[model samples]
Target: MLGATSHIAGRVLPAVGRVPGNVVEAVASRPGRVAAAGEVARRFGARVHDGYDALLGDPEVDAVYVALPNSEHVTWALRALEAGKHVLVEKPMALSEQDCLRIGRAAGDLVVMEAYMYRFHPQQRKVVQLLGRGEEGCGEAEGRGEGEGGGIGELRVVRAAFAYPTPVEGNIRFDPALGGGATWDVGCYAFDVPLWAFGVEPCRVWARFHGDPVDLGAVAVLDFGDGRSAVLDYSLEYGPRAHYELQGTRGSISVRNAWTTPHEDGVITVVTLDGVREEVVPAADAYELQVAAFADAVRGRRESLVVPLDHSVRVARVGEALIRANAVGDWVDLTSR
Candidate 1:
C-alpha cells in the first residue's frame, strides 16, 4: 500500500487481509509518519518503508493499493506503473483529467484501476438487472427490457446526492493544496451513480461552488442532451444524507443510503406505474470485492477492471469542468463549446 495513513486505506488493508489470495505485503508513508506506518505494518504483518519509491521497488510486492491524498494520486500511480506493478488507486484518480491521461499513457497493458468500491456492490448489480441488463455482468445496456423494450427504457433523469454533517478542523478534505473540497471529496459519489448507471457521458456540464478558495458545497448539472440529464448536488454543511434516484420511461429506481449501504444483504425498490417491487441483494463488501478483482487481474485471471482509466478521466473532466464553471459562472462545455 502507498500512503497508508488514510482511514479509507485503513478499511481496505483490513479487507485485503480478510480476502483470500490477497495480502498487504508492504506499506509506505511520509518519513515523519513512521509511527503510524509502523502500527499498520505490525497489524498487517507487512514490511514498512519510509519513502513511497522504496516500497514500489520491493520485488516481493506485485501490486500496489494506493490510498494517498487526492493530489498525490496521479504522480504516485504513474511512478508505480513505471516500476512494473499493478495498481488499484483510490478515487478521483488524479487532480486533473490530463493527469489521468498521463497515467493511462504510462500504464499500457498493465492493470491500473480507480477504486470506487460502491460500483462493485451487489446493489449496482441489482440496478443493472432491473434496467434490463443480463445477470451475467455490468454496463451492457442493450435488449431494452421486460418483453421487447418493456423494462425501464429510455432513462430520463438521474439524481444523486451525498452529504455529511460537516468537516472537523484539519481534515485533509478541506485542504486546498491537497486538492480538497466538498465536491471532490464527497460529491464525486454523485457523479459515479449517474455515469455508471446509464453508462453515458455528458456533452456539456455546469456547476456552482458554495465557497471561495475552498468549497463547503457544490451543485453540478451534467447535460447528456437528448432530453437526458443528471443533477449532482452535495454539501459538507448538510445533515447526514445519501441517496440517488433513477427514472426511466417505464419504471424507476430509488436507492436509500445509496453509497454507504452495508456489505450485508440490502434491499432495492423498483417502482413503475404498475406497482413497487423489492429486490434482495446478498451481503457484499464492495471494497473486499474490489480487492478480489484487483488480485484476480494482477494474477492474470481477469481481463478488465470496473473503473478503467477512461472512466476516471471522464469523472475528472466532469469535476474539473464543474470547478472551472463555478469559477467563471458559465456553463463549461465538455465537448469544446
Candidate 2:
C-alpha cells in the first residue's frame, strides 16, 4: 500500500485482509510520515519504507495500491510500472486525460486498475444486469447478454448526487494544488455511474461551480447525445448522502447508498408498468472483490480489467471539461476534443 491514507488503512486494508492469498506486503509514505506508515504496516505485519521510492524498490512487493493525493497518482504509478509492479491506483487516475493516456501507454501489458471499489459491489452488478449490460468484466462470459437497457427498456437519463461535509482546516479535499474539490473528490463518482450505465462516452458537458479556490459544491450536466443525459450535483459542505436514479423509457431504477454501501446490505428499487419491486443486495466488501480482480489480472488469469485505464481517461476528460466550464461559466463541448 502507498500513502497510508485513512481510507486505505481503515477500509481498503481490512478488505485486502479478508481476501485469500492477498497480503499488504509493505507500506510507505513521505519521510515526515514514515512513522505513521510504519504504524499502519505493523497492523498487517508488513515492512515499512521511509518513502514511496523505497517501497517501489522492494523486491518482494509484486503490486502497489496507490492511495496518494490526486496530483501524485501519475508520477508514482509510472514509477511503479517501470519497476515492474502492477498498480491499483485510486479513482480519477489523473487530473488530465493526457496524463491518464500517458499512464496507459506506459503500462503496456501491466496490470493497472483504478480503485473504484463501489463498482465491484453486487448491487452495482445488479444495476448493470438490469440495464441489460454486464459489469466491467462480467459479461457474456457470465451468460448475461450485452443488450442495452433490456430490463429498463432504454435508459434515457440518470440523476446522481454525492455529498458530504469536509473540514477546510487540514483536509486535502480543500487543497487546490493537491487536486482538491468536491468535483474531483465526489463528483467523479457521479460522473462514473451514468457513463457506466450508458456504456458510452459523453459528447458534451456543462458545469457551474460554487467555491472560491476550490469547489465546495457544483451542478453539472453530461450530454451523451441521442436524447440521453445525466444530471449531477455534488458537494463537500452538506449532510452525508450518495445515490443515483436511472430513468428509462419503460421503467426506472433507484439505488440508495449507491456509492459507499456502508450498511449490511444495499437496496435497489425498480418501477415499471408491471409494478415497483425492491431488490436487497447482501453486503460484501467491494474492496476485497476489487483486490481479487486485481490479483487475477496480475496473474494473467483475467482477460478483462475491472476498471480499465481508458475509462479513467474518459472520466478525466469530463473532469477537465467541467473545470473549464466552471472557469467560463458555460457549457463545454466535448465532441471537438
Candidate 3:
C-alpha cells in the first residue's frame, strides 16, 4: 500500500493480518523517510521501499492498495495497473470524472476497485433489507401502512455528513494543489453512500461552500429521478461526527458514525413501523474485508462490491458539479455526463 504513514494505513495494517489469504508484503512512501517506513515495516514485518517505483517493480507484489491523497489516487492507481497489479484505491477515486474514466480504461485486465469500506458492513446490509420491507415506524409514525414499504424505488431523502478537525498543519488534505478540501476529503462519502444505497445517479446538483483555499464546510443537494433527493453536508473544522439517514415512504434508517466506527462492536439504529430498533452489528475488520474482497476479485473468485469504474466517474462528475455550483451559487445540471 502507498502512504504507509497515513491514518487509514495505520488502521488497515492489522486488519490485513486477519484476512485468510492476505499478507503484508511491502510498504511504500516517498524517499527520505526511511525511519518512518522502517517503523511500519517493523510493525507489520513487511519490507520497506523508499520509492513507489521500487515497490511497484517487485515481481511478487500481486496487487496494490492506494491510500494516498485525493489527487494522487489516479496517477498511482494507473501506474499500478500499468505494472500489472490489481488496484484498490481509496475514496474520491479521482478528482474528476474524466480522470476516473481514464484510469478505468487503463486497468486493462486488472481489477480496479474503490475502497468504500462501509459498504461491506453488515449494518449496511441490514439497512438494505429493512428498506426492502414495507413498514413505517422510524421517521414518520403515520406512514406505517405505506405501500410495499415504498420499495427501493420509493427512496426519497438521503442525508449524510462527516467531519473532523484537521490537526496536521501541512497535511496533503490542506493543500489545494493536491486536491485538498472538506468536499473531497470527507464529502465523498456524503456523495457516494446515497448513490450506493439508491443505486442511481443524480440528475441535478447544487452546493454552497464556506472558507477559502481548503473549504471549511459545504452543503450540497442532489436530485435523483422520481422526486428523490439527497443532501450532503461536510466540514473539516468541526469535531468528529458522522451520520447517514435514508428516508423512504414507509420508514427511515439512520447510521451513526458510519465512516470510522469501531469494527469489532458497532451499532446502527434502524427505525421501522414497529419502532426504533437498535441493531447490534458485530463489525468485522473493514480493511481486512476490503483486502480479501479485492484479492478474491483479483483471483477471479468474486465480483467487486462496487462495480464498474463508471460509478466512480459519476461520483467525480457530481462532485465537480457541486464545486461549480458553489462557485456560481446556482444549480448545476449533470445530465450531460
Off by over 4 Å in 3: 133-153
TM-score leaderboard ranking: 2, 1, 3
Q: Ten-residue segment with the worst summed lDDT in candidate 2?
A: 137-146
Winner by TM-score between candidate 3 and candidate 1: 1
Point out where model 1 deviates above 4 Å. 139-150, 261-264
User: Can you tell me which runs of candidate 2 are displaced by over 4 Å?
Assistant: 134-150, 261-263
Compared with the true structure, the alpha-carbon lDDT of candidate 2 equals: 0.82
Record all residue pairs in model 2 with backbone atoms less than 3 Å apart, i.e. clashing: none
- Candidate scoring better on lDDT of 2 and 3: 2
List, residue by residue over 1-337, the lDDT tens digit for candidate 2.
8887556557888778777888889989887788888888889888999989999999999999889888888999999999999999988789999999999999998889888878788887887777766544432212212345536677788899989887788888888899999888898988987777676777888999999688899999999888889999999999587889988888888988865544569789999888989999998777788888888889897554767777788889899999999889888888885
Error of 2 at 93 (Å): 0.5
Residues 241-268 of candidate 3 have per-residue lDDT tens digits of: 7789888765677877665455355566
RMSD (CA, Å), each prediction: 2.2, 2.6, 4.6
Q: How high a TM-score does candidate 1 get? A: 0.93
